[model samples]
Target: MHIAEGFLPPAHAVAWGVASAPFVVHGVRSLTREVREHPESTLLLGASGAFTFVLSALKLPSVTGSCSHPTGTGLGAILFRPPIMAVLGTITLLFQALLLAHGGLTTLGANVFSMAIVGPWAGYAVYKLLRRSNVPLMVTVFFAAFVADLSTYCVTSVQLALAFPDPGSGFLGALGKFGSIFAVTQIPLAVSEGLLTVLVMRLLVQSSKGELTRLGVLVAQKQARTGTETEAVGR
Candidate 1:
């Protein structure tokens, strides 16, 4: 969800910018460290950024000053963690704001805070929780992507509500209005994004098993099995 340029009050805009700066700065360091330490992961990182850009760019008109779309942050968060996904999501949002006019420069901070920071962290938390409970990998992936996509809109609704509270009902009313409107389109989109993420992960599993293993997405059991199989063959 991208808030239109100049739509939010100046104070709100600056406040959001100030709040978002630290996460983005930390994300930059995380990304740099990831690239430096695992040069082979460069390709996957690029793909994750591209996925976020493409999916988020396919926006649909929604509430005033905002739109609905799939936030492809879950896959990257799952693979490289939320800190790294924050960098990818920020780059995607910035480029879209400049070249595609998908979002506005003024609202970049708010959008980044929602889609890049909160969404990934929330989704990754769910993923980790479910995985610890022994959830199937694909199922964990689906819920993670679903939560990531939906949570961005939820945060956007809160931001909009806070910026423009309803005259009669105040902030709660405004939040309800915005949240209801966002849910109309975002729910299905979230489900679609979840399924799509699962599909992409399946392909990655088949084609980049080693990479997934290194990222800890594929876990250790498969690697152990492969090693055991190799030893058996040798025997």
Candidate 2:
């Protein structure tokens, strides 16, 4: 979700900027370290950034200042972790804001906080949790992408609600209204994103199995083969 330029009050914008600065800074460092340590990963890193840029740019009309879109942060978060995804997300948002006018410079911080920071972390958390519970890889990938896409809107709703509380009903009421409006479009978008992410992951599984295994997205071949045999015997 991209909040339009000058949509948020000055005070709210500054506050969100201040809150988001540290995460972006840390993300920069994380990205730098990743590149320095694993130069081979640079291609995949670029791919991840491209994915976020392309997917998030496909915006649809929604709330007054914001729009609904698929957040493509989940794949990067799953592959490279949230810290690196944060940097990629920020880059995508920045370019969109500058070139497409999809979002504004004034509201970049709030948008970054929601889509870049919270969305990736929340998705990655769900992915890790589900994987730990032994969920199938594609299933985990789907939910991770689904949660990432949905969580961005949830945070956007909160941001908008806090900034423009309903005069008669107040913050809670505003939150409910904003949340509901977003959900109408966001739920379907999230499911669509989830399926798309699963498809992408499947391709990666076939073509980039070594990299995926190195990134821990897939188990080592030996381990996977053993697990498959174990399941066969169990059946």
Candidate 3:
């Protein structure tokens, strides 16, 4: 959910911008390291960024007051890591803001914070945790993407609630109202995005195997498969 241009008060906008600056810097550094260490990863990184850009630009109807869309950073984060996702997400958001006028320059920091930094990292954490616990790959990816998409809207709702509190119930009440509206529309969309991300990952496993192999997904997936086969044989 984009907060739209000039919607936030000056203080909130500036504060968000200040808050996001460090993450953006670190993202740039992470991207630099990835390219430097695994030059072949450049293609995968670009492709991940493109995936984020395309999915994010498709803004759905606002079931509530604000428009909703898939952050798409979850897939990027899982593939390229959260630090790289911050850079890619910013670039995608900036592209839409400048070209399509979908979002806005004024609210870029807030959008990036939610879509790029917050959601992606949260999703990545979920993915890593699930992977460590021996979860199925598809299930892990589904939850990662699902959490990432939902978390972005959750953060956006909080941001909006903070700025525009309910006249009677104050921030807490506003938070509740905004969160409810978001949940209704965004829940289904989050599930859809999660499935789509896994589908895309499957496609990449075939079409972009080399690039993904460079990133260790192919090897990990192979190990998982072998382990499953061994367990079945023992059974």
In order, candidate lDDTs are 0.87, 0.88, 0.84
Q: Write the per-residue lDDT of candidate 1 for residues 1-235, one digit (tens) a residue.
A: 7888888899999999999889989989989988998899999999998889778877665444455689899999999899889889999889888997877889999999999999999899999899889999999999999999899989999999999999999999999998887855688888888998999999999999888867767765745667644543542
Model 2 TM-score, all chains together: 0.90
lDDT by residue (21-77, candidate 3, tens digit) is: 899999999899889987888888888888887788676765556556787888888
- Model 2 C-alpha lDDT per residue in residues 1-235, reported as the tens digit of each score: 6889999999999999999999999999989988998798999899888888778877655544455789899999999999889889989889889998977899999999999999999999999999989999999999999999999989999999999999999999999998887755698788888998899889888888877766777777677577644543542
Report residue 116 deviation for candidate 3 (angstroms).
0.7
Question: Which pairs of residues have clashing backbones in candidate 1?
Answer: none
TM-score of each candidate? 0.90, 0.90, 0.88
* Stretches > 4 Å off in candidate 2: 60-67, 223-235
Q: After superposition, how far is residue 178 of candidate 1 from its true place, in Å?
A: 1.0
